[model samples]
Target: MDTMTYDYTEPVLSPKGQKMRDILADYITVVSHRLPDDVTKKLVELSKIEVDPLQRLIYDTMMENQMLAGKLKRPSCQDTGALQFFIKCGAKFPLLSELNAILKDAVYRATKQAPLRHNAVQTFDEFNTGMNIGDGIPSVFMQIVDDSADIEMYVYMAGGGCTLPGEAKVLMPGEGYEGVVRFVMDRMTSYGINACPPLLVGVGVGTSAETAALNSKLALMRRVDSVSPNKNAAKLEHLLEDGINHIGLGPQGFGGKASVMGVNVINTARHPSAIGVGVSTGCWSHRRGKINFDSDLNYDLPLNEGVEL
Candidate 1:
């Protein structure tokens, strides 16, 4: 059988644009190998809390996995997942026009350099793109900031297992915030195990299902130990974290003292008639990174300390 290749034309970029693309590609590869600082810290904290022999063993193995992955400069998980970028770009940024093309090219480069799994399949076409650059494969969600010349981005690898538990729904207004809690708890009990337990749960509350879903994903980009700024939302974060931990899914769903590293809540105002809630989870691997760049292309990676790209 002849090997099939998806045709994707590379965009011609300016010198600066090419530089940015290469930097992003290197960043992606680094993100693939090393868990972010917050995630690593949380895992270590959780490991000490588990007493069951098998549970402790699982945590030990997880630590070993990270050490080996970093030492060998290889991906920690076989499933590298589809790449997603949540970007906050300034209106005055120099590369704004070329940002999209640069990002797509960067993913293509990372696919080869990281040896990431062939996860981008065309819908209805039923074949892998091979390059990991298919129609909207590296999903980019951007928010524009006025009067600045810098950009901040969150790069996430949304693997299948972690994404399996994601869901959103709109509840009647009368159901109240308590209803949001009920909805999240229900999902956590039913499907959180499949996401590889000791998960990082993200809850989004907004005006509609779509808004809530987007907020839920944004929630996942936050630091594992961070709490919501809104006082009520912060309270709810603790509430949901305690509620999910009570499930006792433990390390890899094997049953133990803790089922979650943390729960983050991101909320926006909603209409009077309805309440929308969405839930998303990050597995124990939790491969996500944050990078910031100035107009001159100087960059800083706050999530993975000591990583140079």
Candidate 2:
């Protein structure tokens, strides 16, 4: 391939396009600062049932913290986490690559605009450059679909505080599916405290560790209280949820009626004799943002003209 350079001609953005980017940046900022809707609803419901004074106090503080963080336009947690953007791009869009770049720039910009803590770190050098960029960092997950011009993006703030506790294992062939459940229960009982509770437990079962891990991460991305379409899997989700909730780890690892907020199962086909399982939990403060845009640049959430981004 020969290198070719072209001079700039048309504007990269129209007035509406520029406004759309700013709006998106604002939405990401809001999601970063507030808990997801389902997680917040669970907290309110918990506060009502919470009999223990300390747990009630935590719930009240959490509810209050929501108000203060949004009003102040600051991140609810100091970690701020690595910015993970899940994007579904339209095939007809002319600016696919530009859109990705713009989003990444927005993440870096939001780190400063939201004044999110400097969480992205360079590996091997053991260094903190104070800016969020690192090699292969602030990753984006993208997929292109057919005949769709509208784009949907899910902005997730996957904090290290919650991710650090994730665990996965490969079970022996002799151990059946029961072995899988046992492994999950064991992992949750032992290390569930490491993740902030009440938690959103994402369980992935598949053919290998990497698949399992990825599936578990995907599981956490699902809406809380949404059950799997697969009957058996949905049942397992309900079972694991009840079991974990009974653990009494409660909010912030205290004791209460809501230990693990919800459990989601995302599984794939596994080898006949081998089973790989993974569990990743999101804390009650599941920081995720969403926005949709049409080809005309009309969009949603985290955007209002005159608002800070």
Candidate 3:
């Protein structure tokens, strides 16, 4: 997805645009060092369910890591990860023309301010940019909203381990939705341990592999306690959660009672002949944040509490 290129002239930013950039940069910094409220809450819930001594210690260590990261104002993990911005912006928004430059600049500044690990490397050529900005680094996906002035953004740190098992495949018509479950379970059993279990699993079902893959990542933006709106998808989420936790990969994959925080499934109408399924996992850290803003640059951090930027 990062291979695609775009040609557009950059624009100068006004005061509002500049403010937006600073806000996003700081938001990224905070997200890197702090866990989102939902993720923190889920971890607390999981930590309480473990019985094994080693597994309980692992959970304790996870909490200590977060505490230290917060106190030191440093990234919670060494792999600060590839920055991904999923933006839903209004076409009529005042800074529309400068959004791209604003986001890129925010990423650049956040890299230095957060002291984020330089994770962006040129593909194939094998060279690190050392600044997390490259031809297509810090992936940005945007969707335009028609007649409104509100923009919603989701920032995600797609760490290597979390994304390693991400896969999408189109199943034959005969394979049915059961194929989707099998695909997720298969991937989880194979690599769930590596991703820091008590993982949040995202599954996508759609008409093609690419669509499913995108939807799968989007699924991770949902709250850990929320179920899919669609009845069938919600059922699948619960079933996948149960099946995964039953695997007993436990905290940090050391074997315990809980293997996952939750399972999220997002779907769209599929082509008559195909069922596409994709899987992505977020490690226990689950570093993702949501913020909403107006054209005036006024914003709210819904996933964060008692924080102002």
Candidate 4:
């Protein structure tokens, strides 16, 4: 193994960096109570747009859940789910060294302040680490996207009930993208009941199984109603959403209309002989938060942070 010792440089931060940490921690607390403003508005609109009376009732109840959760300062679901963060850090940010620590601290603080359930466990040892940190326990995925002076971070709470049925498949070149659709349809129909209904299904098409899996998770980081940036992908989004919703899994998979709130797809070029696909499904109770910060640590809150934590 090559070994070298170099003087480690510690990143210094403006006071804004410290303030940013508190803001982020507090953000987790607030969102844990109320659905993000954008999400609430979308849910309500979806409720109104839903043609089926059964689905409309589910939508109405979901809104009421949001209201009660916010008022009572309680988690909306008992599962609380596994926390994941998809972060894009800027290369020149003064507090790069501090970012990880900041996030870990924020998560810990949020757990206590929100009284978040203890979800982190020490594997093999079979122990709850309690602080929600273990080897990649919070499952943070970070990419240094550019030298620009801003960071975009998303906090996603993925529940086990929804992920229990996730899938990935490798198709032969002859199968093509049609294989992806087939796989999604199979999974949706086969195990749709395991996941909460009115899903926000995230699909990934990429070069490898791991890439596809990661992209599947990333696809869900997008807004529920937002279309993919790629035009072809956007078309696929509409097609998949319609196809799955047609199943009428309805709320809690109880059977009705509105099988999915949306379908979001993320794609990457693949090797000549392989087609990789994966899916990450989010229930209507999808709880994810987005916060953006400048190199100065000035946070641009997502439209969701409507209430004070």
> What ranges in model 1 sit over 4 Å off?
1-5
Tell me which of candidates 2 and 3 scores higher on lDDT: 3
Tens digits of per-residue lDDT for model 2, 1-309:
543332223236645555666766677778877777777777788788889899999988888888899899888887788888777888976556477556655666677778878776667666664656555566787889766777878888888868876888888878976787787788778888878788888999998998888788888888887899888889999888888888888889887887877889998999987788988888878887767777876666432223333
TM-score of 2: 0.87
Worst 10 residues of 3 by lDDT: 1-10
lDDT of each: 0.93, 0.77, 0.89, 0.78
Q: Write one digit per residue (lDDT tens) for candidate 4, span 28-145.
A: 7765666655566666766776687777777788888887997898988766777788999879877777777676667777788887888876666666766655567567799998
Most accurate candidate by TM-score: 1
Candidate 3 global TM-score = 0.95
Clashes of each: 0, 1, 0, 1
Candidate 2 residue pairs that clash: 27-302
Q: How do the predictions measure up, each by TM-score?
A: 0.98, 0.87, 0.95, 0.89
Any runs in candidate 4 off by more than 4 Å, and if so which? Answer: 1-18, 49-54, 305-309
Better of 1 and 4 by TM-score: 1
On residues 1-309, what C-alpha lDDT tens digit does candidate 1 reach at each position? 655668989999999999999999999999998999999999999999988799999999999999999899889899898999999988999999999999999999999998788899988777899988899989999999777999999999999999999999999999999999999999999999999878999999999999999999999999999989999999999999988998889999999999998999999999989899999999999999999999999999999888777
Cα shift from native, residue 277, model 2 (Å): 1.8
Return the number of clashes found in candidate 4. Answer: 1
lDDT of 3 by residue, 1-309 (tens): 344433334346788888999999999999999999999999988888777789889989999999999999999999898999888988788887888789888888899999899888878767677778787777989899677888999999999998887999999989898889999999999988889778999999999999999999999998999999999999999999999999989988788998998999999899999999999999998899998998788899999998777
Candidate 2 runs further than 4 Å off: 1-21, 301-309
Better of 3 and 4 by TM-score: 3
- Comparing 2 with 4 on lDDT, the higher-scoring candidate is 4
